[model samples]
Target chain A: MIRKHGIKLTSVAILIAVLVAWEVLPTALDVPRFIIPTLSDSLAELQRMWANEGLLGHILSTALYTVLGFLIGSLLGAVMGYLLGMSKFWEKVLSPYILALQIAPKVAFAPLFIMWFGYNSMPKLLVTVLIVFFPVLVNVLQAMRTVDRDLVNLARAYNLTRLGIFWKVEMPSTVPNLMAGLRIASTLAVIGVTVGELVGGNTGLGYLISYGGGQANAAMVFNAIILLTVIGFLLYVVLERIEERVLHYLPKAHQ
Target chain B: MALEFRNVSKSFATQGDGELLAVDDVSFRVEEGEFVSVVGPSGCGKSTILSMTAGLYQPTSGEVLVSNVPVTGPNSHVGFMLQKDLLLPWRNIIANIEFGLEARGVPKADRRARAMKELDHCQLSGFENHFPYQLSGGMRQRAALARTLSIDPEIILLDEPFSALDAQTKLLLQNSFAKTIKDAGKTTLLITHDLSEAVLMSDRILVLSERPGQVIAEIKVDLPHRDQPIRRRVLPEVGEYAAQLFKHLKLEEKAA
Candidate 1:
């Protein structure tokens, strides 16, 4: 118990030290405020933005788009993965096009989406969906391919229908991989939304950072970046909790 | 006959090797409630025979019949078990046992009661809520057996079901399984490399040659207390039966 407490204390200490350095180092080294703002300056800018720049609206917009994109992308990916897994002919026929799409950097599509959908939320949502889709699809498809053949044979021997086999055996077997893919996509969802917002968004935390940069206010930019990180971190934590609950039956590795 | 393989031969199409024969013209009959084991050297297609009996594999030529009907596809009348427990790790023990029943569309309450009874029969009563990974290897195999028995299949096809266990666990499981199967009067066909296991539990043993397996020898185990495998293990006749099977397999291996 003490060792556990010790580990927690060490983490806290590291966080405190980083905060102290952020506050103290800039002025101690006589660095200009525009180059590397002190922690106080960033915090003041955060308060000012809260009062004047509708900061809550930006945070909520980014969070909303991140969640919406994640849900839609995950659903699309899972459906496509199962469809492809079930039909080898279609999987073979479509693999080349899918591969080409996957190979191209997802962030590079942000500009194209913006061009097609204009500067509205559509581009950001589309970009987030694109970024989140591939990881889930790849992981689920790989999982479907490697499901235990013996188990499937056993199910067949019981005269389970093809749908029954898929529902009972194949689907449950791919869950671990599916959860893994979702976790990866959760983080990527944030990157996707940020890229879209950076390219053309007029609202959201990404827009705030871009706007702050244009105004040469490093402190405002720093505050927006910190808020964005918090959003991503919260999403990751939520996914991890869900994973723990869903995979409770799986044995944990020995510490 | 509960199970019959009439001149069944199985071959697979290899990528570059054309046709690869596994089992060649094997004929056998398993009477109702009889415990038969097919013992062979490695790669002798012992598993292929079980798969065909389960209707998972079609014979390249001839036929495998269960309860007088030729097996054309996966058969509802057959229960198959393999070396791996193959329990759904995400499911608790009772849920795993209920899998086959669920597939057959048994009512929810009926499935639970039958699965619970099998769990008790297999001596896994307290572990019903525990997942497969939480159980010991012996207990997991017991759950697997419960899963198979829950389906109430006419013929149980076992492909090296106990081969993965340690010697002690294997013997214990063999004794438990023999008693359970005998009490249920289920027709069981076991595939194994262990001659002693074949001799201990089976009423009759079929010895197959190496790859392109044929039923080279058939031994009738005329021993008392066949249901009690542990008791039968110490009998002088058991050793003799094992030795005979070993000789058949060794000779086949040498020829290969």
Candidate 2:
């Protein structure tokens, strides 16, 4: 227990040292505030944005889009994955198109979506969906292909129906891969939303970042970036908790 | 007869547009409540026969019947156990044992009670709530046995079920499994490469030729102590039977 506590303390110490360096380094090197603002300057700008620029509204908008896009995209991806996995004929016909879509850069379509959907939230949500779709689809499909043949055979020996075999063997077998895909898509979700906002959005943290950059306000940009990181971090942590609950049967590996 | 193969033959299509014969005119019968073992070298169509009996594969020529009825597909009256336990990793032992019953749409409470009884019978009562990975290899195989027994299949098909276990675990499991099946009076067809295992557990041992396997010899194990398989290992008759099987296999190999 003491050793574990020491390890946690070391992690906190590293975080604190990085914070102290961020606070102290710029002034010591005589750097300009516009290039790299001090920690206090970024905090002061955060307060200013909260008071005058509706920072909470921007945070809420970004968070809402991130979550909405993640849910829709992941759901579509999982459905498509299971469908393709079960049907060889459809998979063969659609694989080339899927490959083409996967290879294309998702973020590059942000401006196209904005031009088509206008300056509202639709373009950002679309971009986020596009960005988050492929990882989940690929992971789930790979997992479906690699499910243990022996287990399926065993289920068949018991005279399990086609749907029963899928539900009991195939679906449960793909869960770990599905959860891994979700985790990857979770991080990509923020990137998708941010890219959409950076390109054309007027009401998100990404928009604040662009706006701050245009005005050369480094402290505001720093604050926006930190908030975006926090959002991504929180999402990742939540997914990790869900993964733990779902995969409790798996034995843990010790270092 | 609980299980019978009437001139059954199976052939698979090879990559070069050629047909490879597996089992060739194999004829045998396992009496009801009797233990029969098919001993053969590798690639001798031992597993193909079991698959046909289980109705997983169709015979190229003849028929495989279970409980005097021709097997059509996935025979409901037959329970199959492979070398690997093949327990679902996501489920606890009791749930795994209930899998077949659940697939048959048995009521929840009835399946649970049956599973618990099988677990108790297999000496795995306390490990019912543990996952497959949490148990030892022997315990996992016992759980598999419980799962197989829970379904109350008329004829149990064992495809070298103890082949993957260590030597000591193999003997112990062989003894327990033989005793359980005998006590329940279930007909069993065991396909194995182990001559000693055949002599120890089987009332009749069928020796098959190498490829395109046919029944080469039938040896009746007339030894006593059929329930105590491990003790049967010490009997002089066990070694003689093993030697007889070895000579048959060796003579077939030389002919090939």
Give the winner by TM-score. 1
Q: For model 2, how does the per-residue alpha-carbon lDDT over A1-255 read when each residue is reduced to its tens digit?
A: 899999999999999999999999999999999999999999999999999999999999999999999999999999899889888898889999999999999999999999999998999999989988999998998898999987888889898988999999999999999999999999999999999999997999999999999999999999999999899888889999999999988888862
lDDT of 1: 0.91
Docking verdict class for candidate 1 = high
What total of clashing residue pairs does each candidate reach? 0, 0
Model 2 misplacement above 4 A:
B251-256
lDDT string for model 2 (B1-256, tens) is 7988999999999999999999999999999999999999899999999889888889999988887899988857999898899999999999999998988889999999999999998999789899998998888988998999998988999999998889999999999999988888899999998889999999999999989899999999999888899889899888889889989889556778
Off by over 4 Å in 1: B251-256
Per-residue lDDT tens digits of candidate 1, residues A123-235?
99998999899999989999999999989988888778899999999999999999999999999999989888998979998998899999999999999888888998999
**Residue-level error in angstroms, candidate 2, position A190:** 0.6
Model 2's chain B yields a TM-score of 0.97
Worst 10 residues of 2 chain A by lDDT: A246-255
